[model samples]
Target: MAEDAIVVDESLGSETLLDLRSLSVTYQTDQGPVPAVRGVDLTVRRGEVVGVAGESGCGKSTLASTVLRLQPATATVTGEVLVSGADVITMRWGELRALRWAGASIVFQGALHALNPVQSVGAQIGEPIRIHEPGIEDSEVTARISELLQQVGLSPSRAAMYPHQLSGGQRQRVMIAMALACRPALIVADEPTTALDVMVQAQVLGVLEKLVKDLDVGMMIISHDLSVLASSCDRIVVMYAGRVVEEGPAHAVFDRALHPYTAALSAAFPRVGDPAARFAPAGLAGDPPDPTSRPPGCSFAPRCPLAIEACREAEPELREIEPGRWAACIRVGEP
Candidate 1:
């Protein structure tokens, strides 16, 4: 329900809900301008779940924040972030505010920290409804809160509890409930399963997967764990040093990763029943380049096991290899 001026592009054809066209974000620090996200293009179609996987400080979080123009003033953002075809960067303040909960919503990680310790869970969930729908009766707000709670696998009775009173998984479910309160078309979940046990993580992901299918909404789940994305997402995009190194169908990328970074990440997490992987988990050595002083060639060349002199000459462009599969490495097909 953004302003009238913010209209959906007919070219998007109603399927693509969120699109990032060559998006980049740079933060101005005392040290210098640090490029957090660089020339990344991504999309999320209706009823599809897309996952963005990368290590800490690899710009996954920054990319999520930029979806709604949530980046700080010190950060310089470029390129288009089109949610339903409206550019978030160009929207007016009023339009942006209206677009937030109704058009798109975010489920931030660390539910304990994101929620209000003082407010009841119901109050927190109802707050967005009240702000977005002031004319709605208080009784109706309460009813909507209960429905959202039920949808996320939590009892309606749990609404009265505070954040501190709920378990970690319960708190995370509450966060999901809040994100669903407005029934937005798009949901950006930033590390939704972080800090939870494996069992709890599975529960949370199940909830998310079910909701996305039932509601027919597009979701982008960001995380450092490739396994989580592999299990939940339709497509997986692997990022390294502020750029996407490889992207493809979830199973293809997880089972046979083209990029060394993606392969290393996938191997880092052991499979439940795979004997060979159970005994020895792969470890990726070396650190990412400093943002302020990134090398001219491939940023990952220094740490790449298969790096050649050609890889150090210039940065490789992301190109389609086979059908929908894409990789930025010059030596993608090389054995």
Candidate 2:
């Protein structure tokens, strides 16, 4: 019954960079406490790209925000968030500040809004370097900014432009440039491709994958798009109603998902050229349950096509039905 027992993969080895053990987050609202994430256990090894996929309100964004202690003051967090063996939840303010850009950084969605309207892109990117490595010379910081801009496929001259001057894709590149400025060991990208055109999305994603591979940085990419994750991540974790219901290698989880929720999600996003899927893409029948008033047994039972009496009566713990894949369903191995 221990929370950590639900983790699927055991061969992550010693280079595990980010470890989340029984991590939970609850917001103290006027109505009552609303749980956004619940008893989740996850691990991201060095040089690995792990994707957390779910619908908009399924707590993927909350999980990404909580990893860096960016959740609001009204939210109460539990359990551990270890970044390179250090516990972030218990770190002091000074320690957390230092950890923010140096140890780990986030590439948030909506680059147009995340960036300061008044500041130049160069100044924004330089801000992290100045804060994290205080004693570095101005010349060196400027040089680093240029390097980062180029790294993300933007011209060094683009640094002098304000956020409003750049295209959506260019602005996103600026965000990526800022994230890489500190050279953090881990990067959490929350819906990084949101609101961009298809071609632009591919470009931005390509930049992220290249940087992570080139720098050997561990990345946690959170997105509602299973196709995006399947194309970019090594492993994928599927969450429903604030809990991870299925997880495994990207190919297995996306192509042959074991959990009904995961299957529904994958089916919802069909390939562009696939005629069969394009004509009649599958969609889930109902909306996700209300997080504040989630049902007792399986949170997904009400909508699961394969749900049975057992699913409606008792929540199933995440269990490994295959060698490296796990699913939380009573009929995991059954036809």
Candidate 3:
């Protein structure tokens, strides 16, 4: 599929920004090698919000960590991750550190723990600017921090408060503000609304939506909330057991999914503007195969509703089924 697509709605702008090719991350445990993120390729474009949606243990966060190279010591990462035409996986440590803030940044999960309780939010946000461009004066750094706080919808006055002083949504905005301090070209948000109250989730997601529109920054939003992904992202990549099962335009993927896993996830959500029509969320029976001992064929075959003889004997590669849609299911496009 093309990196750039024509904007269906004239109101939103579109362009290509970051791309990942065959990105895979594995870890060596006593049992054996466990693949956390297996052969997943994703893209986020300028002025576009891309959603990576999957259930818990679906490797959504692992994929995000691999994108940022935030892994444990025993982890082995292999694949191409390109940001602004530069391969992240191959960069030297010095190069990687230099690329972090200006090229891309991350709003990781567990913000309460990510932020230091001792320091103020303003100092945390100013750290990047100060470290990266030491020549910039203190006044400029302070002004930039305030602007970032305002951009993420946090009150400028709240910058002086420590993380413990703010609510969940406010803390999340602080994380986002810190990620945006250096005006990054891309942002990776992993479960940005995981533990927030329902009311707070709506408000935080609104701020994220506005960030994409106003800052023109490419975003990779990792979440299991289909409703949020459907509303916030331009495209969706559905991950299953460490692999991408389906990917396409957000609405099209949700409405007309190809893979059985994608279909099950779609069936689990309530459609917008159709609250009166209720249906049980289609649950995929059984569990995803143990990553330590995945099956010979498709990893999802054990739990798939439509598993067949071939599905149990041969793995399928992700391939484009249409001009812009890709799926890893053998049954897709078959009569």
lDDT of 1: 0.91
**lDDT of candidate 3 over 1-335, digit per residue (tens):** 11332353334644456788988888899988998888888878787788999988888988887665777878888888888778878889988888887788989777899899999999999999998897999999889998999888877899799999999889998998999888888999999988788798888888888887778788999998766787778889999889998988888887788888888887777675666435555566777778888899988888887889999898889899998899999989998
Ten contiguous residues with the weakest lDDT in model 3:
1-10
Residue pairs with clashing backbones, model 2: none
Worst 10 residues of 1 by lDDT: 1-10
**TM-score to true structure, per model:** 0.95, 0.95, 0.92
After superposing candidate 2 on the true structure, give the runs of residues whose Cα lies further than 4 Å from its correct spot.
Answer: 1-14
What's the distance in Å from true for residue 77, model 2? 0.7
TM-score of the candidate numbered 1?
0.95
Candidate ranking under lDDT, highest first, comes to: 1, 2, 3
Clashing pairs in 3: none
lDDT of candidate 1 over 161-188, digit per residue (tens):
9999999999999999999998999999
Model 1 bad stretches (over 4 Å): 1-14
Q: Which stretches of candidate 3 lie over 4 Å from their true place?
A: 1-5, 8-16, 275-279
